[model samples]
Target: MRTKLSSTIFLAILACLLWASAFVGIKIGLPYTTPLQFAGIRFFISGLIILPFCSQRRDYFRLILKNWKVVFVITLLQTFVHYSLFYTGISMVPGALGAIVVGSGPVFVAIVAHFSMPDDKMSLKKAGVILLGLTGVVLVSLERGSLSGEGKLILVGIALLILTNINSGFTNIIVAKDKDKVPPLVLSSASMIVGGLMLFLFSIPIEGLHFSAKPFEYYAALAWLSFLSAAAFSIWFTLLKRPGVKVSDLNMWKFIIPVFGAIFAWILLPDEHPDVLSIAGMIITGSSLFLLNYLNRKKIVR
Candidate 1:
């Protein structure tokens, strides 16, 4: 049991760290292409990247067909609606604001699961832990400096980001509820392919055919983003399907994203540097995770 618990924690952290790295990659790639088109290509390639591992199962295509309805729903919610709002919102707001909003995702997911899942209902302890994590996120984001921008546009962007969180919560519930019917690889691959294709086609009309000759760094960023997306989503899907895993509890791990995101920014982006607030935020966030695990182990919260 200890071994299994350790493995789950390890995998969850691995997925979150992989996702965090996308912050640097996206920043690098966005200058060369439109947001939707870049995201589309990244996810489309991500689906293809997972294909070989999936091919090991001879009946993979058949499973995807059988689970097409759920796949379609997931594609719409997870990729289409989620990223559409995400990219649009992030573009409108400051990056620090975007990071805080994205970091708050787990809170929304917890609320959604509380109402949707019988066994995953919220508790005082869980709510406290989640808020504590969000506080850490806010501190980390504020380290970048105060927001100085158009108020109305920032509000609108924030609203869109909040909606993305709600959409994500619903998507996660669907995945958890349907975990038994669809294999993780099939669900992830099919949804990413179909949804990514839709985004790419949609972008061509609105964003226009803007992909042009670019430096080696752009391609490198794209390649890294694609690979990380494939691996992270695959790991996440498998973990979500594990027996005894609760949506809210599992999602709390996402609080790690911004912590690692800050670290990655400091390391890779020359403009970024470490500071006291980020370190404090990291400590607070880590404490929340520890509190959550302690509560779970003590059966202090359900």
Candidate 2:
């Protein structure tokens, strides 16, 4: 039991670290690559990496054919729409702010799951926790100056990010509900391939098949994002398969990404550190996330 618990904790920590590093990686790579090009390459590479690990090609194809509708919806929400908006938002907003906004994903997921899944019923306790988590997100967003209209375009970028989070929640609930019916490795790989192809198609019009970055930074970012996607999603899906792990529990760790993003900005950008008010805001957000997690855990155990 102790060993199993330790392993779960390790995987959770690994998930957090992988997610946190993505913000830093994106910040490092964005200067050299356009958002659409960057997302396309990352998804393409991720699909390639995941292709080999799929258990059976024939079975995978059958599954995709049989479940094309659901698969398409998941791909659109999880990969196509989520990445397009998220990358665009990341490109426009500060990395820390983007992380904070993305961190609100669990709140959206809980709400969606409550309405969509009979097994995932909503409780007053869980609802309260979700509210707390949202409070944290709002605080973090405000601290990051995401609430202010830095510019009209940046404000639009923030709205895009909120939409991205909603899509993330949709994807998570979809996977959690269906992971037992479908093979996760196959689903993950196929989604990436289809989604990457779709993004490639879309990019032709918006980004025009451009590849104009120095070999070092551009390829480096692609590599980082691909690896991050593969590692993070694998562990995330694995955890979702575990019984009794509420979506609200996941929100507790969300704040870590923003904290890491802040650290990354300080080290890499040097000029984007939070002001005193921002620091205070981060504290409030962090506390709220903690409270949400605590309340959810207590409810789960009782």
Candidate 3:
């Protein structure tokens, strides 16, 4: 049991790290491609990479046709709406700011999971840890200055990022409910394919394809982002399949995203630099995850 738990924890951390780097990757790629177009390409390649891993590969289309509605709903909320807004939001918002906004994903997930999932009900201790995490996130985000009429576009992007979190929360519940029926790899890859195609089709009129894998850095970003999605989604969905696991519980790990995002952005982006407070915030954020698990474990012991 300890070994399994440790492995899961390791995978969780790896998933967080890859996801955190996505902020830098998107920033790197945005110069070469528009937001939706960028997302489409990223996921299209990602889906192709993971599609072969589905267990029932022979019955894939039949499975998809049978489960088409579920696929549509999941991809619509999880992939299409969530990421379309996310890519757009991350495009306009500064990488650090974008990371902070999306880092609030756990708060949204925990709240929804508490109400919607009986076994995942929230306790006062859980609530307090959540608040602590949010406090840390808020501290990180305060670096973003006040909004102005001239900065309305940034505000719009911020709003999209906020909505993106909510959309993600709802989809987590949906995926939790359907985890048993659908194979995780199949679900991840299929939704990615359909969702990527949607973004690709939409981008045709708004932002015509200007894809070029030229310049090694640009190609590397695209390739790495694609691998990140495939690997992270596979790891995440695999863990979500375990008995007694809760989406809210898994989501606490998301706080690590902004922490690593800050570090990676500081490393990759020339404009951003980390400070004492951001480091402090990262420490606080990391503590909150342990706090959450400790509280939950204590509850179980009782």
Candidate 4:
């Protein structure tokens, strides 16, 4: 049991790290493409990347057909609605800011899971830990300064990102509840393919067929984004299927995303840099995860 728990934790961290880097990748790629267009292409290719690796390659389409509802709903919410809001939000704000907004997702997931899953109901202790994590995220974001100058654009972005989290909370619940219905890889591949195609097609009419020459850097970012989405989602979906995994608790590990996301943006983006508050926030966030794990081990909280 201990070994299995350790493995789950390790994989959770690995998925979080991969997702963290996506902020940098998205920022890198968005310079050359529309948000929906970039998101669509990235996810479509990510689905293809996962296809060949599925165990029953011959029965892939059959599995998708059998689990059409699960695939369709996940495709609609996770890839399409989630990424559309995500890409649009991130494009409006700085990478670190975007990370901070998205990092608050666990809070939403916790709330959503509490109401949706009897077994995953919230406890005061869990709520406190989540808030602690959010505090750290806020501290990291404080260095970005007031939205007074950035105006309603950043506000709109923040709102959209929050909506994405709410959507994600429900999506995670569906995946967890239906864990036995379909394999994670197959679900992810099918949903991403359909969702990505939807976004790409929709982008044509909305963003207006924008195909132009982009630099090598753009392709590199796009490729890296696709690969990360493939690997991270697969890892995450697999974790969700594991027995004893709580959607809320599992998502607490995601607080690491903003900490690393901010750090990466500081290092990679010429315009972004770490401040004292950001570093302090990272430490607090890491401490929150430690507390969360300790509590879980003690079985003090769900």
lDDT of each: 0.89, 0.69, 0.80, 0.89
Clashes of each: 0, 0, 0, 0
Estimate, for each residue in 1-302, the C-alpha lDDT of model 2 and write its tens digit: 34544465567657776777776677677777567766777777787787787777668888888888767887788889988898778667765566566777776777777777677767786666666555655555555554434667777777999888777777777777675666777677778878888887888888776655376866776688898787777677677666665554554566556655565566666556666655665576567656654564455467
Candidate 1 vs 3: which has more TM-score: 1
Task: Provide the lDDT at 14 for model 1.
Answer: 98
Model 1 per-residue lDDT tens digits across residues 251-284: 9999999889889989999999989888899999
**After superposing candidate 3, which stretches have Cα over 4 Å from the reference?**
1-4, 91-97, 142-155, 211-213
Q: Give candidate 2's whole-model lDDT.
A: 0.69
* Model 3 TM-score relative to the real fold: 0.91
Q: Which regions of candidate 4 fall more than 4 Å away from where they truly are?
A: 91-98, 149-156, 300-302
* Residue pairs with backbone overlap in model 3: none
Candidate achieving higher TM-score, 3 or 4? 4
What is candidate 3's lDDT per residue for 10-107, written digit by digit as tens? 88889989998997897687787688887888888888899888878998888888888887898788778988788778667765576667878898
Candidate 1: clashing pairs of residues: none
Question: Could you tell me the lDDT of residue 54 within candidate 1?
Answer: 86
* TM-score for each predicted model, relative to the true structure: 0.96, 0.81, 0.91, 0.94
Decide which is better by TM-score, 1 or 2: 1
Candidate 4 structure quality by residue, lDDT tens digits, 1-302: 66777898999999999998987998788878888988899999999999999997898988888988888999999999998888788768765577677879999999999999999999899999999999998888777655333778888898999999999999999999996888999998998889999999988988998878999999999999999999999999999999899999999999988788777888898988888988899889998999988887777334
Q: How far in Å is the alpha carbon of 186 misplaced in model 2?
A: 1.5
TM-score, predicted candidate 4 vs. hidden true structure? 0.94
